[model samples]
Target: MTLALLPRYDEPRLLTAQMELIDQSFGIAMLGCSLAAMILASGLAITGGHPGALPWAATMVVACAIAHFGRLAVPDRLTEARSGRYARAMTAMLVLIGSLWGLVAWLYLDIRSPAVVICVLSLIAGMSAAALAVFSACLPVAVGFFVPAIVPVWIVFLATGDIAYLPMFLGTPLYLVVLMIFARNYARVARHAIALRFENLELISQLRDQTARAGQAQRQAEEANRAKSVFLASASHDLRQPLHALGLFVVSLSRTTLDAHQRQLLTHIEASSGAAREMLNTLLDFSKLEAGVVTPRPRPFRLQPLLHKLENEFAPQANARGLVYRTRDTTATLFGDPSLVELILRNLIANAIRYTRAGGVLVACRPRRFHVSVEVWDTGIGIPTAQHRDIFREFHQLGNPERDQRKGLGLGLAIVEGLARTMQTRVTLASTPDRGSVFRLRLPLAWTAPEEAADPQIAMRLDGLRVLVIDDDAAIREAMAGLLAIWNCPCRTAENEDEALALLDDFPPDLILADYRLRGHRTGHEAIAAIRSRVGRRLPAIIITGDTAADRLRNAHADGTALLHKPVVPGELHAAISTLMRESEWSRAEQ
Candidate 1:
């Protein structure tokens, strides 16, 4: 039992907690003891005929009150130094109170009446019990009070040499021993409780620290992801600018008369340029998807026309490969983003055509009660069962171990899956090795009116039209001017907005074609806006951007002006210019 108390003495925190618990109840203990003393002293003076006892008891009560109230002077925050001082002061107060009780027990034992002496003994025993309950949190303080109060009475009983008081001398010590054991046990329980409380507090603090660190790590990961997206967008734009120029140069060169060998070499250059453009487009799509910028706008549309369009687009490639191409059309109305659905089907058909050497590819739509499933089937070198799920992963290819650019960049199925997810759908694949493969996209069915007839495809003539090209890249500016010249169009080129505006003042070009990113933190949109504002008329303009950044695309779209991506195909560029010119003419007529 003594060893158990020794552990608490060595632990400063446990000792401090015990002292705090003792301090908390000190006032109540003092109040109860002072009141009890006053009653006992009054009863003794009345019954035992001792008038001096009342005054001495009154003094003891006053002293106890003063001592308990003195604890209020201690600070609320109990540091180690303050707690030690408080504990010592409390122990001294207990000793003083015990001495007063002992003095009363010694001085009053001479009462002749047996009833008065027994009442006095009862008062001493009662006070000891109260002290045990109050100061049990500190065993030494409880012992200080208990021993003095009870032991003095036993000594007084022995001094009387009375036979009847002999039992009290033996019983008093026995009572003291039991009370001391109770105080020791209570102190042990209190120390255990305080230790557990502090341990819990420490654990809670550690958990909070871990939570803060985890939050910081999560924020860092998000920042790194954002940085990667920015780097990819910047790199893609820079690479596309040169490729755009090369494609334009190749188109311009093709128009010139050349020998048979040179023409064949030019054809190879065109194919290579086309492949590079496809790869850049794939990267751009991937970056946009990773940045979470693509949004699906679902609308109801006829599936037959969409199938016919895909058939026309892929028929040329199929014929060139000597493979049969077929489509089973339906008048089924589907709900989804039409452009995204078209992109998914196009990739599936392209993949089919690229892989199949001898057999044909089929495009069909299967109508369900609530939705439609558009499937592309082909008798190509099929994917193995194990690699079925892996085929949709980016840069994952089947049977193309050499990574031949001619076969494709292995991003076709990956793009298909991404676009399907954006539309809240999924693309599923089924294939058997050496037999064939089928890719299906499921879309909800919707009720919609039949679409109008298709618009005519007219060739846009650029002959004799005045065009202004703005780009920070000198090579791009030169290549663009040369390409426009080949179309017999007079063109002016500028490197910045100020130069372009300067050119606008003298030449007053019919169309403005500006790159999205420009010198001095300017953009093609800004250049076009400035030019339109300066001329005091809505200009027919096009924003040609090599950037595939989501914010750039969104801004360009919000401008509501014509846009063409860089490494621009000459035919597409011509059509964009023609459309803007026609729209501008119509607006002028309305005015």
Candidate 2:
């Protein structure tokens, strides 16, 4: 009966909790009330002169004794498995007790003394109210007690035609009905609360599982990214080796005598190699930027020469493309790395030209109170407002659906942004779709103008320069020797550090061009250290390498050597050596 009254939710825990609540119902307070009621009712029966009161009282004492022991034993048996049997036994007990109390109430109606009858009635009412408190949780159990007990009291009042007992008969049944309703509501609340608790627990468990999966996925993604980085570095190094040697050989061949037909073929070859070199150099620039090897040297510098240099470099391309590449001159002296600023402007201009098919590109500078804004304007396919931020991201391009290598790898603007960030400046873009976009670079203002570098003579004397080329590759060595011969500069080539050191006695190199990675786990830096130590002179040196690894690049250029990556341009190579010779310790101290 007790089990039937509990709400069924198909959850084992809910049923178990209900049984536990029912178990708590059989405790000291409940048993004491029953025993006290039995005693007080028996006393009233005897006071009203009823002879049957003695036996009834004795029966009640026995029932109360049995209930006391049952209450003590209830907790041990109060499990779901035992709940059914336990509930039936409890119902039978309630019937017996309720019948005894009803008999006591009936016995009171026969008492002639009004005061004794009143006392008996009071006891019956109190006992029934107590049963309502104790048994009302289960409606079946309440019904068992009330049917036997309340019906008899009602029958006696009606049969005897007693006006005094009418109120008791009417009000007692109503009171029991109210208690059943209250108990029903209480059980509903308990059931809902239990269901809610389990639901919350299930949700928490799912959340934890999702969190674990997400963490694992993140770890896997990070590992894949690292693997990608390693592959790119390795591939870049290998590809640069051959291209570097090929570029050197091409430049060396260009200097030799050739017929007009052969010269044109050579020109085509130069163009092809130059395109490849440009792509590779772009990759190298991105790698250096990623490795944080590119640092800006900000100083007060005139902006006109930089603009002129860019104009000269891009003007030919603009003329070939039939696009007007105009630069409005500004005497504004900006404070920033001229080389970095040039690279930024170079990319922006190149991008402007590439995107602008029929229209022209403009470069101008605007002076402000504390800074100068260098703007690159173009009349090409403009950008959408939504993609302004995305354009700066590496490899994100617009309108180049074919992924043309000529337009670049989409890293030009990324590199520009990186250089700008390194120089502590910003690049902003404003555009409308189908129209040209303008990219503006803000640079700090300079109070004093920097000294201009003297323009390189059409021919710089390399007559007295004795060069030593240290490389493990035979082709690179031969190419360097051939290229140096074209410059009328005597040179010696070595396959290893030992061979190079041995040649020092006869060759006594005035300049060292050493490949970074050499045979015997040796590096050009180490070879140069040994060479300087042996000759007791700080020779002008350059560490030419094909390494694109971030950590290696950082360590390679740490000592401030004139480091150049593989596939070096003959013009740039010549200029680097010239600059080194002019400013080296040997030139400054000895010359």
Candidate 3:
């Protein structure tokens, strides 16, 4: 019945932990019990001088030694299968030891000496207290030892039926009850402590798992970003190659003698090509901004020239659409990346020209004491107040549901916002329906040296000047050669470095033009470097590429080589080649 009252654990791990705790302290408990037994037996032998007492002392000592040694012989690591059996065996051994102690109490009670009876009762009480402390981790084991040790002694006192023994007989049961209560309370405390320890361990395990999962997710996101960059790089290059060739072909065709109708057709072709190039550029700009590769190079420059450039570029478009175009110039010297500022202004003006079907557009700069605000006001179908915020989002256009490519890819304003952020500034917008919209870009004012005059336009004549062109694509090579031939420049072409070097040995050209990415995983820079080494002279060179990857753009900028993006404008290409040739000529003359 006492065993039934002992605490029962539902968790297998908790039960195993209790058994382990018992096993760890088993030796200490046995040693203490053995010492106590020896002391009691010695006292009994001296006072009672009973012959049976001596034999009983020897039996108790042997029993304790057997129990202790038997525990030591069990395996160090208890498996689940053996843990229950081991616990039961420990309980049985403790009970046996307790019974042996009880025998001492029963036998000594017959001696009829007051001193011997006191000693017997004291020993039984001490043994019960020791059992409570030792076996508390496993409550059933404590109960098994405690009941056997005390019940026998209490029964003996009751049988005596004397008045002196009556107080003890009545008191013994109450005393037993108090000890049982202490054992049960201690058992609960031990169970709670073990439970808390396991709970902490489980929490730590879960935390470690969550940390690992987060790290894995972070790595996967980084990998996906890298893959996206690679795909965009490949696609940009592949798509631009044909566009570059076609632009060159059109330039070559325009040089031929043609009727007025044919000339008008060429103009239309150029317009379509120009529109396609703008869309492609917008896409590339968006990609670069998303990849965080656009850096601003700011300098103090006059706003008049930049505003005038915008006016010149858009005035014709505005007139063609029968909308008024005007500009108010200020001599305000603003500090910023001039090219980026121009990009923002260009997009704003372009959007205005595209959206305004009736009213004119105004481009103006207002100077303040500390800053200048460049504003673009359009009298087009004004933006709704609800969509004023959404207008800046990528690929979002108002009133162009058919997704017209001519109105642009809806990325112009997005690029404008991104560029403003790069410049550490914000773009302001104001609009009312059926009225107009205004975009104001504010910039800090700066004082600087007077601006230098633009470089004088050099003669585009390339007659008798030998030029080398190297490209992997056959069409690009042929188109480039034909275009250069139209300028009366003698040209040589190659498919790779080896072919270029072979061409150089026979006809060393005055200028070298190469594609950035070449076959066999070679770069145009390497080819240029090799040719310069072979020639023993630093030759003027240019790197033309269609790659819009952020890293590639950064590398190209760092290389200090003259670069042109693919589908290059005929006028721009001619200008770049002419400028490099002039610089080369100046350097040679100085030598």
Candidate 4:
């Protein structure tokens, strides 16, 4: 680094470094001179004479220190005017010290002794050398000292006009030139060093500032994400109530007689309602995944059946999109959570169908030593290798920048990743751009075991089933009444826990379907608890909630009752009811 490369703000700093060198030089030069004077005085005293160099050395020390000490007394944070004045003062003091040293040449000028001549010459040479060493950090200071010290000695040699002395005069100017060059180079080196130090310090400061700002930005982004999640959870719960009621009403409408045109209109309305419900469900799934609520219940399951189920679900969707769907079935039984495995497969196969436009989608199985790798391969728009990690992030989609909801909400892969982690496994991907993509899920293969007789479960008939519905929302209570009316089940609707318990006096409910939250913050579990106490039986109950809270869902699962999120599909509600009924029947039969 050069002085020019340094900012103008550091001019004072450069000046201060040069001045520090001068400070050290002052003490050293004075010490050297005092020692020389003592030696000279002792030599002359032995010869019965007095030394003249002593007084001259004393005077020079005083003169030089005047300006140097004045600079020290000045205030810190030197301004431009003050620094300039100090430089001029130092240069003048340097000249005074040089002239005094030069005058030594005249002290022994006319002496005939050869020893005196040699001593004078040696002393002047030492002074010139000292000047060069001490003040070279600033060339002007060096020049001021050396020029006055050496010129008088050069004149002494020339005045003698001896043939032998000619070289001294001729060589003096060359000596001075060499010293100037060395001093200038030394000054540049000093300035460059100071500049480099300041630059490094500035860079370190900037790096710290940038690091702090980046940390703050990351914190802010995380806060925003958390706030957005809270808002969505609140909104999801509020919206689900009406949609749940609408879904029930729609289910009842389906049981009525209708012509072709009316049926088509009804189907479109159902599709629109289904789309809204699907998005909400996706959000609910993501919430549960984040809340660590999904616990995989592992068991021995047939891999081929899960594959067959996936094929049935996505094959029609693929066919509708003008693409082929195929599954290379494997008879190998796998041991894992059957439902969670099915959910993961559904996400992967759905993604395969959504992205593939031309060729087809394939589900295949490869047997490893300990794990069976179920792969979903597709001739879809392939993901780049760089984006393989990002594709699993929530709301991060590939080739869908416009965020087409029909393609998906971008939570499918994120849910898959979360579920896979909860199951203590991982998902891997291999893809080529525009060629195809393959997503593989590795699961533990079940070892061969003696087959136990399976207990068959038959669907429970809903005819004449006594059901009780408890909800604070009137529309929900009315919807429940209408739905059960179509089912031809004798049903009673209650507004509170008291009403539900009161209904059990005469018309006891065989099944209780209760909203999760009622008036005064009462839960479905509370109302169902009252009903069971009144009936003196652990009657089957299903808790239907619009809450996207995973903690509540997990807690609800602990009591071993059926749970369903709202905007519930007709088929899901019906299945849950039938399963709970069959379980109640089995429990009674065992007792």
For model 3, what is the alpha-carbon lDDT of residue 410?
88
- List model 1 lDDT by residue over 4-100, tens digit each: 6531242455667877787778888888778877887887788777888888888888888878777787675256656666666777788889888
TM-scores for the candidates: 0.81, 0.76, 0.81, 0.78
In model 3, which runs have C-alpha deviations exceeding 4 angstroms? 1-9, 47-73, 109-134, 163-167, 178-193, 257-272, 286-295, 311-331, 344-443, 455-460
Q: For each candidate in the order shown, give its overall lDDT on alpha carbons.
A: 0.83, 0.79, 0.85, 0.80
Cα deviation of 258, candidate 4, in Å: 5.2
lDDT of 2 at 176: 57
TM-score of 1: 0.81
Error of 2 at 557 (Å): 2.9
lDDT of 1 at 234: 85
Candidate 3 lDDT by residue in tens digits, 1-591:
976766554355666788888877778788777877777778877766766676777777788888878877877536666677777787788889889887887777763787877777777787788777878887878877887888888889888878877878888889888988998888889899989988999998988888898889889988887787688677878878998898999998988998999999999988888877887788788877886768898888888988888888999999999999999968788899998999999999999999999979999988888888889999989999899879999889999999987888888999999999999998999998889999999999987854676887766688887999989999999999998888888999999999999997789989999999999999999999999999999999999998888777888778888988887887888889898998888888999
Top-down lDDT ranking: 3, 1, 4, 2
Query: How does candidate 4 fare on TM-score?
Result: 0.78
Candidate 4 Cα misplacement greater than 4 A, ranges: 1-13, 20-52, 64-69, 75-85, 105-133, 231-235, 255-261, 381-390, 396-402, 421-424, 430-435, 448-456, 459-474, 477-563, 574-591
Stronger candidate by lDDT (1 vs 3): 3
Error in Å for residue 404 of model 2? 1.6
lDDT of 4 at 69: 66
For residues 354-453, write the lDDT of model 2, one tens digit per residue. 9988889889999999998999999899999989999999889998899988888898999999999999889999998888899999998898869777
